[model samples]
Target: MAYKTEHITQQIRAAREAKNMSQRELSARSGLTQSHISQIERGTMEPGLSSLVDVARALDLEIVLAPKKLMPAIGNILGSASVTSDTLTSEQRKLVGRLERWLAGVRDQFSIASEADTLKDSLALLRHLPLSADELDRLREATLHLNRWQDDPPSRKELSEFAHAVRQLRNATVHRDRDGAVPRSAYALEEEDDDA
Candidate 1:
């Protein structure tokens, strides 16, 4: 089958547009030259794997593969059909405000982690996952039985462990098929599936 470079480039351009970012902004975020990013979005250049990864990271996106039949459902969930920020209920708005403030604080914490020269940024980011209240409660309950469970306020190491656990949960729950392997960049799944 022919590779649809146009489709690939179009999706990248659309993603950047949806985020309201210009090619120059994306280039800054992804550490690629603006000309390269422009070439990429214009379909004049096919990005290398590393370039694609950098761009995806800048967009806070993960490239997951699913069965063709499930694409519609996946697309629906990823679509912005949920209530907009402007329409949020008062309580919902408060929660969102709190979360946004917390994120700002966490960004500082991540910077501090960097200043300290530790791998704490990853932990800080994972701790800020926008889990629902129910999920938060469930995670808290599960924390009691964790092998590294600490006191009411977990230490940096304990927090790191918790973040690792959350990452584990995310990996297990997302991007899995019936047989549990998700490939990357195969336009179509093969009759005999392959793991990427």
Candidate 2:
């Protein structure tokens, strides 16, 4: 089956609301156009992987993809059990803690992984997050922003700007290259400057 864009979009929208964010705030955070966010939330657009990451970052959420079976097993045995947030059983809390740790590891690993591998791993990880329809909408918007980045590589100055925008959405530290910067290729810059 094709990837479920609508489902994911909905989740983004929901998450944003849960965090009490407005569309404009989300747009500013994710570097996405407000209109595009609206379209995705309305189920009129499907976003790519990079956008999803941006949205997830904006919401202080992380994405992970493990085997589908493994997630349900963990959720059922841990999250859905008699384990309220305030009253987590030792085992239940431990499982959630492990998942969080694993997710952190995955994020760290992505810094060194090939871009293609990073994208794939990100998509998989995203599937494991407790996404709702609204959060998915925000994710779609963020994905659109990333698409723009891929289409046109920014200049070093532009990349610095882009990175700053990403930092806003991510609300967390991002890994930089060995030089403490994310590089933008010339071709990528050309692409970004060209008007579609």
Candidate 3:
């Protein structure tokens, strides 16, 4: 029971952070006291069903019961869907991994480390932003260039230039995706059959 509460709290905290929401904001949205939310998130208080539902709904989530035996299948489906929906492609992931390995090998170099850090930070931002197909293609092209450089350590100047380009890409994405992405609702409303 303690483990379940911890897991639930962790999930709720992670979701709230991912949405860039503060605890007070969530409290306001959920109609719960900030201290109550804090206690719940810390696992110091066990939330009642109604409070849990309120918090979940405020986080754009809902609780659902699934057969224990079907958990693995559900996990697999959701995992694949997440990968498909994300902006990163397999090739881009490979390139990023390759770059990270290279960066790790030369972490002692101050100039290279600074530029590498910038590139890495920009990449993280780029991954989170909702991108159009054309913007995604642009990202693919950038990753392809980065892939070609994977075998060679770029000079500080070159790395800085690449980092700048990635930041520009991230900025453009943010400007274009002003509204952010809307998540799919968990429940669907059914229309009543008037003829019946």
TM-score of each: 0.42, 0.40, 0.43
Off by over 4 Å in 1: 1-3, 81-83, 87-196
- Report the Cα lDDT for candidate 1: 0.53
Q: Residue 9 CA error for candidate 3 (Å)? A: 1.3
Q: What tens digits encode model 2's per-residue C-alpha lDDT throughout 50-98?
A: 8888887888876677564244233333232223344323443343344
**Scored by CA lDDT, what does every candidate get?**
0.53, 0.50, 0.65
Task: Compare the candidates by lDDT and give the number of the best one.
Answer: 3
Model number with the top TM-score:
3
Candidate 3 per-residue C-alpha lDDT over 120-155 given as tens digits, one digit per residue, 9 for 90 to 100: 776665544445566667766766665576687667
lDDT for 160 in candidate 3 is 70
* Over 4 Å off, model 3: 1-3, 81-84, 88-196
Ranking by TM-score: 3, 1, 2
| Distance from true location, Cα of 146 in model 3, Å | 38
